[model samples]
Target chain A: MATFAVDKTKNTIRLTAMPKVLQGLTVITVLGLIVTLYLGYFNAGTDIQQGEIQRIFYIHMPTFFGAFTAFGATVLGGMLYLAKRDDKWDRLAVAGVEVGLALALINLITGSIWARPIWNTWWTWDPRLTSAAIMALTYAAYLMLRSGIDNLQTRRRFASVYGILAFSTVILTLVIIRIRPDTIHPVVIGASPQNAQGSFEATRGVVLALLPSLLFYSTIVPITLMWYRIRLENMLDVLEQKKIALLSEG
Target chain B: MNTPFFSVVMAIIRKDLQAELRSRELVATMLLFALLSVLAFSFALELDRLAREEVVSGVLWVTVIFASLLGLNRSMSIERENDSIDAMLLTPIPRSAIFVGKLVGNYLFTATVGIALLPLMTILYNINMLNLWVIATLLLGTLGICITGTLLAAMTVQTRAREALLPIVMLPVVLPILLAAVKATTGIINNAPVSDWQTWPQVLLIVDIIYLVLCLLMFSYVIEE
Candidate 1:
């Protein structure tokens, strides 16, 4: 059993134990990640053109979806925080940003690695790449601005609004390949742009390997990470309140 | 008695304009900054006539964006220092009216700087930046920038970092506007056919409307006590 309670007198949150669900989810996520990696490395068929470097695609594309899931939690958390004025929702929103940024970084690194052999460069200023870079920066700015404010309520309110607005960058990153005809980034699901480089068909082996990776990344990874982050934040709150209490007593 | 929405908006706008006219501080700083940036770009790039035509659109938008950031930070900090925002919130007029008023004032000042940059850029870059399409793109782009900037500046002004925080947060949000504006300006300057570049301005218009509606709806929440 887990205990998460707010003590009004001390003005702090007490979270005594990790929830069973979170622990179970963590185990499942770790196991799922390994299985997905194995499937990606061993089970998936090699691309006739690109060879083994293409294996990074399984991690590359799904981590973006992972980022998508995390940032979506941010938008939902932000909206709910604003409507209900709940600090827990605000915690969820910040957790979303931190997790989302990590996943987005993974997506970028994997893409860069994959691009070296496929696109023949470590990076390009394609629309998808530029937007993804900007998307990461936007959320990073969210964390910076959130820290600059000291007032709890005001910080929550402003962060909620900023978090909600930052989702626009995510949406733009996801759709830029579709809209920009000049991009050379590959599109796996639908028709690649006439100029797209390293485009590939999503064959059965590709789908079989990608589906579980996508499922684990988009669902379990972000959720498990965010749960731990939120718990850590609650502990930090308790520490902050204790410091304030000590100062007042002194 | 209920204050009419338009009248309230107009009154706030009038108040900001009147204050600006008396001091002439905001526009003067932004205009001076805009001029200096153009000069800096020209000296730094050292581009010949052909190269200038390719890069001048980017220079124009970048200058405008930085100038707008200066004006927005100044405008919002002024409100914060004087506690005028609180007084405005106390009034019965709609909260969004305050946003619209500040947006209009910021837009006008930034747009003036943008328009004035046209002839100077033409002279400096040796390209005809006085085209109608370029001016339209300028207006549409600035409106979108001001919409997001005003909302963001309000939040940043309350933070410890103040002016420095505004650009960090606002820049990425308004990047699509910057890209579209630069593209449109580049196309028009090069005299490209409408089929090639019309989509950029249309994108600018759509993004402007979306930001406008979003800022209006979100303004009251940001300013709440």
Candidate 2:
């Protein structure tokens, strides 16, 4: 099996080839997504009130957890990077933001799609909605600010600190529904607020379909994508070092 | 010679305040920017008197936030101009004392601008903005802004786009403070029951504490060589 290695003296990173394990996991994750889609569309019964539009819930809700998991990795990667001063952890942090952002965007877009039919508006200034939007912007700022720094070491350090602090937005987005009484966003697990709209019970088939999708999205999808991203970053670092060396020689 | 921590903090604060007193640049710019922002908001919003009362609080917080952004960027850039930050790092006192000192100086300047805006807004909008609760909310919210702003300003001042990056990075982080402050101010202005708006101030306090602690812990990391 090919392996990933970093040479300290030469300042180079090498990945001979894709590992068989990651290849297998990617295939498994794709297959899992297909199975979950089948279970959601074909196996689960339609809702009495919301009708055909409700199946999007399978993707909508799970993608949020997917985002939560990815952002959580960012916090972890940030802390580890700061403590160890390792470039690999910095790469992990960057990967987390990219993957987390994609998942968060999916969550927001799906929620809007679901809300259009049910709530009769594509967007509202509700607490939950606003916080989710802020959460996405916080990480988007992370990427923009990260690229604006020139020194690699300072970039990594500042990115770590900012990454750790930015998690507050994610926490706020998660808890805003529970804390703010006026939010119309529904809670799936617990008793939703009195004014919550479009909340449905988690029946057996719904649970069966949702559980696998949630597991796959929150675990397999983010891990696989972040792994690939980290590999790409390592390769980029190697190219950067080679360019510098060529410049010095010339 | 090892300088004591509190003394180090006081010295930094004294230095910043003395510099401002000599030139009157930071606070003057912030106050003027804040005043212009209030005027611009009033004209742009173009609300009726009743609607103006509802929106005046949002305008107040937004102006304070942007003004503080200006002060924060200038404050750190001054440190960078002559490598004053490196000199401070060579001192014997703890690094966090430097953070605390800069934080207090920034907080004081921003809070001054926020407090001055109260009466100006009251006269302009015909809403009672000089209440004690509103002032308290302003102090708490600006404290939160300065805490994060000081840390981020230090980071952004070292970047290619120094001034432009501060708001883009800071606004989303401080959105909670803006939400709480605006809610509290609006409720107070509308003469709502104490119970109606009390939680907003409490939220402001909690967020302020959280940002203060986080900034104190991370400030050294940001400014370190």
Candidate 3:
């Protein structure tokens, strides 16, 4: 039952409640707020050249960076799982993708909302926005791929491989545009300054807001992961108990 | 020592081709669905003159994508239904060979639609559709789509919600291919300068290779169950 339930067979130093984990979350939130406030203060007098609501960049750029980092982590986790074939590695891959997928979603939503005020439209196929949208969608598909398979082993294997393959599309996002630049989205480099998509140049305050937000994000992901793992093991335990009870009754 | 890798590839490819030819079920369904999609979009778009010119690429690609999804879904579903996939697994072939062979089969079927759609769409839209670049992009784009789609289809085939789930998972994963293909094809249509299509071919091709390699490595794991 313990094997099926918690999987923590020979518990080393079981303290029951994980105070540090709880305290970790609280500290992340508090620090995130302080950093955000500091960012807002630093941006006080500096105005953006691209004009419209440069203020939003404080929130937006960090989200993009953090999301990219999470995706990078997801891909890395996928590689690790494929090499190691450990469920622990697969768990980390899932954790990274889910959190990364969320941040990517937020990046898209906030970018669109910000675009409305800046670009005077809800959306533009700007390279950054279009690529980010595709990234979110790609990883979201990675989630569905995970869900479609119920066998724990196969699910982990296939999803991790798919996750690794996703990096190709990210490459496609950059190079494909460079190869065929005449479409709607602006190119970020090489041809002309005019071809550049939304600027990612980070102001110092943008950096402040960005750093804490990433910290907040990184902190939340593992806890959610541990919680999900616990639930999964608990569900398995209940199933085992029912099976055992039936056998004993017979 | 030589491993007979090439022979293994040919054998798997031949087997898959033989299976599809014997069945003839997947291509027939795909062709019908492809025709239906093109027809629906034609009527829906109402063939406005400028509209046809402007949306030529969109109309052509969407039809191909949706039809290919139907074919991709059916390909694995049929294998599972007949337990052929399991039987195939019983063979002593390397699982990676199976992945490559399935990809070849998928590309053959999808590319047939790609070739057929050229004249069909040209006639329907009343535009000159034959061009070197157009054909090149068609081949490249469909290959990119099939490369990933085959992998996704195999993964989704064993699931309970097979039908509804395959495309939802596939489309998102292939967004880059879709975006690049559409953009490149659209550029070709507009007769834009070469500078216009400088990146997509390279990007799409790189993506195709990456998926091809990754699919091979992971396919053994996928079918192991």
Candidate 4:
């Protein structure tokens, strides 16, 4: 059961925050770094060919994997909202889009920086990049769709539906581009599907470092969503009361 | 047995078609807008005997998707502008039936334009676009678009920004089908063999099934509010 504490003297309401939320995020971030550093500096020795640029992999891959996890959350939140009619799920969907968008942007930038040293070109519409762009564009549109709808319930419902369906496009944009014979981007690097599919031979040491980062990123995403949801709920409450007061005065 | 369910389905379809026939204004506007879209693309790019196959596929699909938005907006608006959606809700018919009915209406309206475009595009581009595979992909792609579009249209119908918000909500989700359709379509136009598409056709089929089934199940809750 949820317990709420209200003080008459101060006119304040306090609720116990989920304590594990912060712990989990911190652990994940710390672990993510350890893994990244381990792969870059320690367990995996410098590659015979690409030295410093190879180090960026630690940052590039995890953020994207994390971004995919975040996009997947929108799909799940979308499904739950459709099933339950809960606004919590809707807020989670929006939060996932925002989180995923940030990470995807990072992933894209890191890849481009890495590409300049390796591919001799800063940009390639490789399957994965294409897919990422499409995914970001779709969710970005999801946000736009929500903004255009003034009615709260309708916005959530429509965006939830659109959110789930949009994820499907990521497949075509990313996967097809990867599979197409004409694509120029390397598979294992930032833009290729083959490399992403099974390219990195992650040592046991690398996995230990990376898994925590994944755990960390995933854990914080929901908390970020929950905080947003609460704020929205509070705004909604204030609006409703104002409406009722106006109705009574008239 | 194709019992009362099918009849109920037919009746719903008939009602929509009849209403559209009486008010031909909606389809006429959409068709006109679609043709003009084609005109713009033709003049802007000067699609001709020498135009590339990839451009042909891209132009045809783009026109279809935009025209779809037109049909979807007008069709769903019919319910929201009048008290028709509320009236339909009060009936004993299943919510899925209403969804299916709307899906069919949107499909027919959009597909009519799609069917016409293949020949029209062929004549303009000076290519034989009467390929069965391209036609099949178009049909599947349109089916996915309508299924997803109807649910979004229903939800958007109640919003303050009705027509304006439909494409914003739709294009991103509809992209995969569009991508696959465009690719397979180009391959067909370029005379690439069956060997070209090992799984593209399969992908389109899966997309259609997923969108239709998910929309069917979730549509009831969307309209409930």
Candidate 5:
């Protein structure tokens, strides 16, 4: 009974503190999003070839990075949960996957829109595209696997195993472009940049716009979303515990 | 003189084979499914000789993959039905022994079905799929597929969705194997320059080794009651 009282107070403190933090984060993210949009639109220079369609790069590249970051978090969360058996880490893994899925969708959709203007096809089975599509599907299956299991502990264990294993796809997606020279996608960090067909040079203005967008989308937005998601999960956890406690006592 | 681990693995493999031979269920379904799928592809594609030669690799792999999915589900179902997995788990044998045993069993089932279909595919498309390179690629590729598929089937067998969920969870994870397999098969078929096709085998070998080690390491987690 004393422990239950302690639990109640702890839950209250966290519940009270969460919304203020979330409110502050919301204001900051909205401001940062606005600035990113301004930098992307009014500040970036026009591409030599792709024109305005090239501007999509400002979002597409950063979102892919963001999704990659989120997936990295998923793997970390899964590893920690497996090592420690903590529900918090499991929640973090769940949040990472959900947020990563959204970011990956943005990456794929913007990529499609961008490709139509540049590659002249809305979709191609290029290695990078194929890998990203597979990565998205892999995590989608991860989520489905979570839902299919009825036992909570078994579900968490399976999810941890999958979260760790499925990261191969993310690594494969990231490297396939750099490793394969035949890819049409530009190699931002490797030898095949010269071979890239429609890749534009990152000019001074483009670099400036790209910097903040990368920082914002890749870290700030994902962290903010994860914070809120974790808070919501904590609330659900507390309610579930309370319900179980009531049932046992009654 | 077999080490205990080897004995355990071999015993499980032998048990599975004895049961399968007695029932003849998994391989029969897989073989029939493979043949029907190949026939279906021929009817649907209706390609000329030149076109058929180009498409035979793709057609053959698609048929084999789908058929192997059927075999894998049935093989895992046997464990699920009589609490056979529980019986295996109750043993003191290492979890990896069970995994390797299932992997070898699935490999033989899927490979037998895949190899039997090759001649039929050759007859249907009038292309030679009997070459030594094509057969080698088939063996290596099916080994990779069965290793990954067996691990995933174990993970999925207890889920509420059971059989329906296996392919969804398995396919994307096994994309590297499928991609390399198809490329290697196509390379052998096209008689492309050795340089053009050399990477496929390398990729298959790496993917197979990685998946084998990873799945072995992770099997204990999935099998934990």
Candidate 6:
């Protein structure tokens, strides 16, 4: 009763049609992209101080939110994998991490680009930026650790546990920004930044641009990426199984 | 009566200490590495009078973290070398006890290396690195490292690139602890008010407890499969 089926003899999974979720997600993503580009170019008001560079917030903030959500999904997938020992959950966990890494990279680059004109430097050791860099490094280490492991079951198990453990960095990064007073990064939606420079309220034009950007980056974009990544993972698994079967048969 | 879990843990720690005492390999290398790291930092950076005072805390922590990686790698690899981990897994003792035992042993070895480096750092940096508050921070920080490092080392020991992978996996994860430790140490060295730096130890304590509990709960999975 599934939409896709794997042919064991041929070692290929055939999909009759795209799943409804993927199809719907694609439509929403296209619509969201057009709306975001329109708003970014037309509607969002330029900042009094930061000028046009502040427009990056439309994409930057949403990617930051999306990256956090991806990491959260990784934790959820990891916890479920541990409880159920399912390969699907492991696939979800890794896909979440990889997608999250890409999102985080985008968020960092945009934030850095935004910073260059405002903060007068491309990089500073601001607490939020520092923590983001560290978070990226931690997850990079997670993927590297996964590669070093050879056995399939053991790798899955260790990666799951590590996935859970590495989440501590994410928690620390999120919590530190609020609790600690050393950060110069603006707290957009929450408590005050220590030495806020260009923080602003979400004006009508800004919110119009931001809301759809959030819809795309935080939900539509990551889920679509996850869907494709999972499909690729399944195909890889099929090819690996076919190779093993062929070797044993010979 | 059979030995309790604590005694089992203590006994394992004793076995580790006795083996370390007999061979003196892990601590020796760790200490030498720590010392050499200090020399390298001093040579690489022109530690003038003000620079020496400011750089001591950062140098001390970076050295300790890397040196602890060396100790962590050896501690776990020793168990995995001769089918010993398999024998330990087969034993009647609880798996968490195995974790506690290795954790305690690693804590002691890393702590010793940290302590040994203090006097050398004091002499090289021309600032007194051997202060009470600094030692307290070092102990607290090393305790955090030992808990996480021991668990991660166990996971990495099963891999082919055991030595290379431990630091890569560990350093970033342990950055918060090192950051807090350095902050507290710097505050103390500069005679800043305790209120400014008090948050670091509290953060370190919370991080330590979180890592300890999670590593304990998760060790059974890592050791089993």
CAPRI quality of model 3: medium
User: What would the per-residue lDDT of candidate 2 be over residues B71-140, giving only the tens digit for each residue?
Assistant: 9999999999999999999977788999999999999999999999999998888888999999999999
Better of 2 and 3 by lDDT: 2
Residue pairs with backbone atoms closer than 3 Å in model 4 (clashes): A28-A216, A35-A209, A187-A192, A187-A195, A188-A195
Q: Which interface RMSD values do the candidates have, in the order shown?
A: 0.7, 0.8, 2.1, 2.1, 0.9, 1.1
Relative to the unseen true structure, what is the C-alpha lDDT of residue A108 in candidate 6, on a scale of 0 to 100? 93
The residue-by-residue lDDT of candidate 3 on A57-134, one tens digit each, is 555545655565666666777788878876667766776677667766776777677677546789876665566677
* CA-based DockQ, model 2: 0.78
lDDT of 4 by residue, B73-153 (tens): 888888878878888889877888889988898898888889888888788777789988888888988898898899988
Share of reference contacts found in each model = 0.78, 0.78, 0.63, 0.68, 0.76, 0.71
Candidate 5 backbone collisions, by pair = none
For A1-250, candidate 4 gives per-residue lDDT tens digits of 2334333467455554444755565565566556556655666555446765666776676677667777788888888987898777886788777877888788889888988877777877765567777777777877777887787787787778777877776555446545565655455424544343223445554565556555654555444544544455555555665677789999
> How far in Å is the alpha carbon of A35 misplaced in model 2?
1.8
Candidate 6 at residue A193, lDDT? Answer: 73
For model 6, report DockQ.
0.71
Deviation in angstroms for A111 in model 3? 2.3
lDDT digits (tens) for residues A1-250 of candidate 6: 2345466568566754667878888888888888888888788888787788888888888997788888888888888988899888999999989999999999999989988888889999887788888999889988998899889888998898888888877777777768667787887776577587668776788788888888779888888888778777877787777788899999
Model 2 stretches with alpha carbons more than 4 Å out: A1-5, A8-15, B1-3
Tens-place lDDT digits, model 5, residues B25-83: 89999988888888888999978888887788888888878888998888888899999
lDDT of 5 at B171: 82
Q: Which ten-residue region of model 5 chain B has the weakest summed lDDT?
A: B173-182
- Taking all chains together, the TM-score of candidate 2 against the true structure is 0.95
| DockQ score of the complex predicted as candidate 4 | 0.59
**Candidate 1 structure quality by residue, lDDT tens digits, A22-136:** 9899889889988999999999999999999999999999999999999999999999998998789999999999999999999999999999989889988888899999999
Segments of candidate 1 deviating more than 4 angstroms: A1-16, A246-250, B1-3
List residue ranges in candidate 6 displaced over 4 A: A1-16, A190-198, B1-3
